[model samples]
Target: MGEAARYDVVQISDFRLPGGTTSSIAEEVRAQSEAGLSTALMHAAGSVTGYPIPWSTHIRRILDLPGVHVATPRDRLHATVLVIRHPTVIWSTPSTFDHVTADHVVIVVNHAAIDGAGTRHYDVEATDRRVRSLFGLDPIWAPIGPVVRGTVLQQTTEVPLRDEDWVNIFQMPEGAAERETFIGKKPVIGRHSRPQPGKWPDTKEDILAAYPNSPGYDVQILGGAKIARRKIGWIPDRWTVIPFGGEEPFDFLRRIDFWVYMHHPDLREAFGRAAMEALAAGCVAILPPYMKALFGDAALYAEPHEVLALVDEHWSSPEAFLAQSRRAQEFARSFSPQMHLRRLQELGVAVPETGATRQDEPAVAGTDAQAGASAGPQPTFVLNLDPQDLGLARELTRGLSATGSPVVMGLVADGAEKDPLGPDEIRLPGPPAFHLVEETGAGTWRRYITQRLRRLLADVGARRVVTVGTTIPEPVMEAFDGQAVEHHWVRPDDGSPLDVQLAVRMNAVSAIAADAAPETLAVTILKESTL
Candidate 1:
């Protein structure tokens, strides 16, 4: 197989798992690959511990990149650097990967906390020792940021975390074409995070202090205020409560004057990636005083009670507001992919000098960033799916993808999610390609719809909904942006003639692959329904 396809770098992480790790690693790989490097990304996030975390869409999208390979398990790869994020996988099972040989360095970037309170917390000292024993090379300990570093310092008698912070690598979304200092209207203040209970302060006063609905200010929260609403008891009259992912990250950041973030007192704010993204968007970010170590002058910090006065101070002077905004963007460069590439080189990875573009920070918002401003909302297709329909969903997704439009599929099942195929019946669906109908532990599949896919549908403006062999979930229905959406029900029974007919139409869909409009595909599917 052509000398087994050697690579310059091999990155391992549990990708099927969601959240920022996979996406951050993918961004780093993309940057390296763009600089004319052969990089291999592997999904080994839960492999060593025998957890069955599945492949994520990030890995799928990453695989499509020109020089990046999503390496399969046990695929022997030669590399100069073998970078692993949150390195519990190797620390537990030394044989988890016997194939990757890092000729120079093994950079262990920590994305998790050191405490074992969570299910997947990593021990920094243990990981460093283990990597040294396993590879005979002392691995570089790179904490994501001060928050992550704070945890590492709790027991720093063993390994010293380098001064260079391996903060979460992020690419800012399209920025607002015009930078307004909020002079004419009330200064808009907001924050974006998941609607989890731990994301907020303990009291209503503190919550309102951070997000005031005062007549002098406008509050726009992109993440749903479920916990905040529960704490406040009554929703604020003027606060524009947008469900998380209801709008693109940059779009929401653009509307706000300041990116105000405050976490629950009990939980430590470990490297606020969302806040960093805000800074990259040139939005003035205000966090609690503790975040000052990581953000410094790039963002502002104050206690809950002092937030508005800080805002008033900034608003009183347009020059100060613009200066803070510009400072935010400048500080965001420290976490860009170019900085990641430089970080990789510091650890002995021989990055090629051929790509001169490697010297410059990547342009986060350029002309293409302005496309979404004028381009009206794109159509989204939400495929209501069940475990029984994964094979069908997989096929349909292939056809839908060719249509050049976004698709949302929420196939997660509530309660006890057994495998779709019973022990006695194996022929229908076979071994599944996607994740389960249900996943136990922290990120339950039932919460998948409410937490993730629903917000994604909202963000993309899902206009057409299709349910095959099952009724749409009520939770999904509640989140659909009102009225414009069209819902269609396909054959209500699994393995019905509807499957055969639709499968044939989907197979024929390749013929119309050139048709990029989602409306075209929707028309074809509805036309086949009558027969």
Candidate 2:
């Protein structure tokens, strides 16, 4: 045989074990390795672990896998710089990209809300920019579920059942054995989630109060620290608080009859993996109205006040409970690892036919004119600025105006007051475009601004856009997607007026060259930097 095709795939994310929990992105990496892809998992930041757990131990544990390789760079910044030079596919988990540039990047979003709390937290504009910066293309977003394998649950042994406890019913694969067939005398209600403020509803105390010290029912709170911190006025005998780490989530979930998640409506879960895992373990899930789209009939919807009543209704009727449990189990199967792999393939992600070694190629370097010539015909350039940076924008505009390149200035109107200019006013050679993005209570105005900036760039036929600001916002950096366009970020404190002008001009030229010869541009920049 000649040479085997390389199956190199790198996953960059916040991965930890033992004291900390692993994200769904890490799980996807594991699945990819099992499918015959040569996979490497790198920590987005430094080695993540609980106290007393050394980084070497974590690495050793992860490397034990047959085809999985693990690497923890000095820090996130180092990893970001390293991946840009690597000649292999790089996958970044949610919201890790900073100022670093990459050619082939696949970003996976695990949650709906990105920046902060509430439904509007989905910073559509920033997400779009992030996709563009990583992929060098426009994004077409679609909701894709995570790949949760059965193996995540297999690590922990099963907890023995009690005669007084009612087992949660679930549907198995075709022709699989029917393990559970009876309902117990007492109901064992449970809640499994990170014990965070957002995950709990405002009426948490009321729900806990419902499970009083009685023979009919008992409550168990799994996942999180001791319940003493909650200070919910309930007797010690009423409920059991199982802190994380003693047993795996599935082990605790398997023992519970119902899996209730009473998260606040404001907090959005991109895809509730824990709830899905509960479903896989045959626990009938109780979710809020917001989760309807994700879980469908797989879970029972209940308001905060109706939680106790809903549980009572299910407890009274065994047939109805079993049907819902079976539905949830079936729905959970849809998020299988195999299904995720196929979805990735459908999205045009390359999979190597045969495993082989990675090719280490040095980047090519060239001058601005040569790079521009190779990039094809010269195109228009725009200088974008936040309203606060209007002074620098003016200086850069005046200096670059002499270069004879068709340059325009654009202003982003954030909610904050502008020192010199009003909302609609900013002086420039050509009519300055004002993008008014008012901040609503939803906290997503940055996204709106990013969207407007993208539209402005496209409208002006901007081949290269230079942003002059104190510090470029991550969202704004992301908006400069598309192979036809190049984005350069210039800080106000970089140098004197002449320095800024020269830098802008050079960057403009560099952008033109970058469009034509990315490899040459990378080599040139790498040579200049210590990295």
Candidate 3:
């Protein structure tokens, strides 16, 4: 037979394994590996030195999945560089896209859509633009279903049922066996999620009060120490509070007759993985009405106050509860790992039997050049320098100028009438072009600067612009108006001074000028400094 086809598929994310709630990203990686793909997981959270003293069992399960190569870079910047260098397809979460540049096809799994509350709202459209600006390509959006489905499939297969003696021959947890053996006697009600104040409903206390203090019913609040602590005094006589981890959460899920989720209605659920898990375990869920699109007929919708009444209605009628529970299980089955893999295939992610190109191959050069040529003249590097960043700005200008790229050095005056740069501060090996702006309040200055920068970029016929500073002012970004521009922040490493940061920025710019593809837009360099 011919040599096995070589290809690389990698998943990059902030959290590698399950922590409080199971990471759907990790589950997707596991699913890919099971489908005979050579997969690697680059943990963007960086390195873990020693074995975690108290690790979650769910995390351990993920670590043990077959054929998964895990890597932890020294920092996120290094991880981005590594991701760019290898792989035919790069899969990432929206939050993990900082400083990451993907020359290859990128598939973004959007787990959360709406961010911020009330007037400070940001939706998927803003996220899409940010990703496009960073990577220079619109990413294909994938749902979180496959990962959730995979979890349900694994749990259903791994956990033996009470009716199946042959399956129970394998050693199992006592709680798992107990869960399978115990049918509905007294109504068991619970909710599982990462404990965070924003996730709780405003009517949480009122919802809890609806559950009677009777012996016939049981209540469990799973996940998060803060939840346990806050509800300690308020917990009813038959209620138990369990922190997230081990087999207990899963056991509790198995025992739950009604899964009550009281997340604020204004907040988007982003696929609701925890709720899906509960549904898969045959727990009839009572969630907010806005989630109808996400859950379809799989869940029962109720407002916070209506939750207790809904639970009572279901508890009083076993047939009504069982019917909804069966619908939930059926809906959960649709999200299986196989379906996820199929979706990835549909989106042009290739599954090769053999490894592909070496990591050092020039991935971005040709594309960058073509994109630059089509846009306008050769690119210009602009540094919006504050007083402290002047030295670094000067160094970057010299570096980019050496590569035959035009450079503009701009000063951010601190609302002073005179120029921020004095004769002593103006020292440079070669004279470089410069611009000056007087900084004012956020509203006025942002508009003025953006307009000035836009004119400057247009006048220079700049095909691509790289902005270097402490931070790229939001106005500068808005000025680009979704044009091709990159942001490079001058940040020193721990214990390093301005000179060290200058060196790092110079090196990163040189690399981009040398290797960046024409299609490249924005890139942020250097790890964030603490001090």
Candidate 4:
């Protein structure tokens, strides 16, 4: 870019990095435009990897380019070329560039975008269509790959079971923990499948009715918050919604009884992770007929949309689900974490078995910290209220209370504080199950109420902590440091981040513990005597 600039000046703009997008970019472009410099617009394109980009984000970047008119010889020499496109912006959502306006858009396409079959064939088409619909023009589709196609999606290889008995983990709808024991344990049926369109059982009620008369049979539904909510609505009374009370979904997957493939016929996968996990857990795989291709005779196959039939005939028949579970264990004894890492390394991704990726470590840690409240077993759950968003709060409380004893600490403006449930308070789904802790402050400033919150958490329990704050507080962060419970911050709408974080943290810690100290971790694996 500098060499081209030596021949002629260039000022690049983008929606990534510091000041690449947002008001700063607008200010920069406005400054240059006002300075009478002739500017050229350069736009970059690709998938948005991880950073959050919305439809109007590109406009912010375009607004920051100062030389939109025409660059003079002096302008060309002195002008700084701002390259706004980076890997992060490309891998994210595609419709993030609708509002952007550029005189000339230059796309920096990477090899992944150019040569990858998934990207070039499907993703690129979808992205271009979206851009055209929203922006009234199509950006360039530059191919930078060396005209070579990579391998088809990899197949799963089995890994050794860490445990003879099946263990599964998953995030619950309400932030809660669940553990169930099958007495006699003769026919333990582990289901690690999800509800998919037209593939999963018609409803939770119908699925629950499967093997209704059969006693000592349990089915645990594992999923994140959305799935948890759906399960709550559809769960068969016979099947229990077990909250793998953890910060990460994988933690719940780690402790499941066995794996069931519930994907719809339309959906195809290169590899079935949950099915592989069931094999790893020494459980049999009861796969849908369609996904049998992915597993072959290694797993037990059943028709889709027939969860009840499968449960009654295949799972409920004498020694059926159990027999299949053992076969699954034997099948999944080759795909280790080391193998996954090695594959990524061969792809030039340089994934080390230990240490961290230079780019992803801090962000991952920060994300984990934010998602997993650094709390111990008996930690306090903080609930901040803005009289307006009480509906959301009540929904959270209802979900939490169903799984664990949640301590709700409500914060309000000085004069606004009233009966724990004020005259204007919306009726909670049920009478408040939470122990009410109140803090009164001058306003919604989180800093002002941090001291009161720290005291409240200490008084309750500091082992496991979750907070719902309208705003992030410096004091609360300090309190988290002191208490060590995973802390999470959520906007009013995107509340699931907290749930997923908790699920992930629990799984990671469980993995770390199981890998490091198998004996101690085994005892805590929810057995009769331990419970």
Top-lDDT structure, candidate number:
1
User: Which number leads on TM-score?
Assistant: 1
lDDT of each: 0.60, 0.46, 0.47, 0.36
The regions of model 2 sitting more than 4 angstroms off are: 1-8, 16-21, 46-62, 71-104, 114-124, 127-179, 209-213, 225-236, 349-531
lDDT of 1 by residue, 3-106 (tens): 23356677876666444566677778788877766677666545433655555555555654545544544544456777777566666543445444567555
Model 4 lDDT vs. the true structure?
Answer: 0.36
Clashing residue pairs, candidate 1?
Answer: 13-45, 14-45, 16-54
Ranking the candidates on lDDT from highest down gives 1, 3, 2, 4
Tens-digit lDDT track for model 4 on 136-172? 5444432212121111111111211111111111111
TM-score of 2: 0.50
lDDT of 4 at 299: 75
Name the runs in model 3 displaced over 4 angstroms: 1-7, 16-22, 46-60, 72-104, 107-116, 119-136, 143-184, 209-216, 228-233, 246-248, 351-531
TM-score of each: 0.62, 0.50, 0.50, 0.33
- Model 2, residue 221: displacement in angstroms? 1.6
Candidate 1 Cα outliers beyond 4 Å, as residue runs? 1-5, 47-60, 88-95, 104-109, 112-121, 129-136, 170-178, 334-336, 354-531
10 residues in a row with least lDDT, candidate 4 = 358-367
| CA lDDT, candidate 2, residue 113 | 29
lDDT of 3 by residue, 1-531 (tens): 111111245555444234422255556556665665544444443232123332233333454344343332211211111222101112233234443333343434333332324322223344445446656765444333333222223323332111211000011223332122225677777888766765666454644643445676787778743643365445465667676653455567887888888765455654676777777778888888867767889999887668777888887887888888888877777666665555556444554334432221111211232233334325554544455545555565556555555444444433222232321121111111123233212343344445555644554455445444534345655666655544444442233334444434333332232123222212222211110
Model 1 lDDT, residue 168, Cα: 73
